[model samples]
Target: MDAMMMDAMSKDMMSMPGMESMDMDAMQACMDACSACEQACTVCSTQMMDCAPACMNCADMCNTMMRSMMRMQGMTPAAMMAMLDACIAMCQVCMDMCMAHADESPVCKMCAQACQACMDACMAMKATMATA
Candidate 1:
């Protein structure tokens, strides 16, 4: 992350009531991964591959997940959990679709990798929430 982003995230984190004690590093990492995945999925989806639907869905879910993190003040724990579930589902769909065409397109392979990483990050966030 850049200094400006870290600073902004720090300010946002400081304002959240109980979020001060949360793992800021993990959250930032997940957000970064989501942003990267969203970009890759968007570009890959434009290729008109069979994975287009899942890629579009993944892009949307990643945007939602990133925006929710950016605006944490609007989220309750239940809402956050629901979002995580949705993101994970989207990632699974995208990954499955991309994997099917991995042999035909390098973009699909890369997109699948991004989706897998995003799924892992979302799962980590979900685990953290469960412990909280």
Candidate 2:
């Protein structure tokens, strides 16, 4: 998202109960990671590998997670936490599936890296939300 957009979101989100003090920096990083993971997974899914199914699923999950983050109005902290947890879990599964054959496929390696980054970002977001 853009700075102007985030600024607008910040103004709107400040009135939300649990998200009143959300860390926009962490949110931005998580969104960026989710987008990268989604792209990587979409590319990896087209490789006709055994991990393709997991890659596709992860891509969808990442997209949903990013979208949810971008649209936080009426969203509860618990719901956001759940979404983060789901995103992290999906990323983990995809990473594991891709890592199994990563040595033989550069795309799998790239996808695995993106999944790991996404997982890390989600975890960070979760932690920040918990403290927010």
Candidate 3:
């Protein structure tokens, strides 16, 4: 999304119960990372490898995480934290599975990198929330 759109969404989120101190930039980055990870996992899942199921699960989790962040009015701080943790865990599992075949499959390598990026973004968001 564009800066104007993210700013607009952030402004709307400011009205939510626990979003008063939310970091819009960090949130946007996390959302972007989730989107990228979802796309990478979707492609990886079509490879029929051992990691396919994990990639599929991670893709779903990332999409849900991104959507939840977009709809902050329906989320509590605790729920958001839990969801981030879940996204991180799923990404880790997917990354590990993909790395096992990374040498043989270029797609798996790409998926692993995407998973790592998603995990980093989620961690950054969590850190931002902690100080908020």
Best by lDDT: 3
lDDT of 3 by residue, 1-116 (tens): 57878766536664347657688789889999999999999999999999999999999999999999888888989999999999999999999999999999999999999999
TM-score, each model? 0.90, 0.92, 0.95
Cα lDDT, all candidates: 0.84, 0.90, 0.92
Residue 106 shift from truth in candidate 3, angstroms: 0.7
What would the per-residue lDDT of candidate 1 be over residues 1-132, giving only the tens digit for each residue?
A: 555877766565523345444456667777888998999899999999889988998998999898888777777777878898899899999999999999999999999999999989988987876676
Worst 10-residue lDDT window, candidate 3: 7-16
How many backbone overlaps does candidate 2 show? 0
What global local distance difference test value does model 1 have? 0.84
Worst 10 residues of 1 by lDDT: 14-23
Q: In what order do the candidates fall by TM-score, top score first?
A: 3, 2, 1
- Summarize candidate 2's per-residue lDDT along 11-82 as a digit string, tens digits: 675334565667789988999999999999999999999999999999999999998887778678889888
lDDT of 3: 0.92
Q: Considering lDDT, where higher is better, how would the candidates rank from best to worst?
A: 3, 2, 1
Clashes within 3 Å, all models in order = 0, 0, 0
Give residue 111's error in model 2 in angstroms.
0.2
Instruction: Between candidates 2 and 3, name the one with more favorable lDDT.
Output: 3
RMSD of each: 1.9, 1.6, 1.3
Give per-residue lDDT, candidate 2, residue 55.
Answer: 97
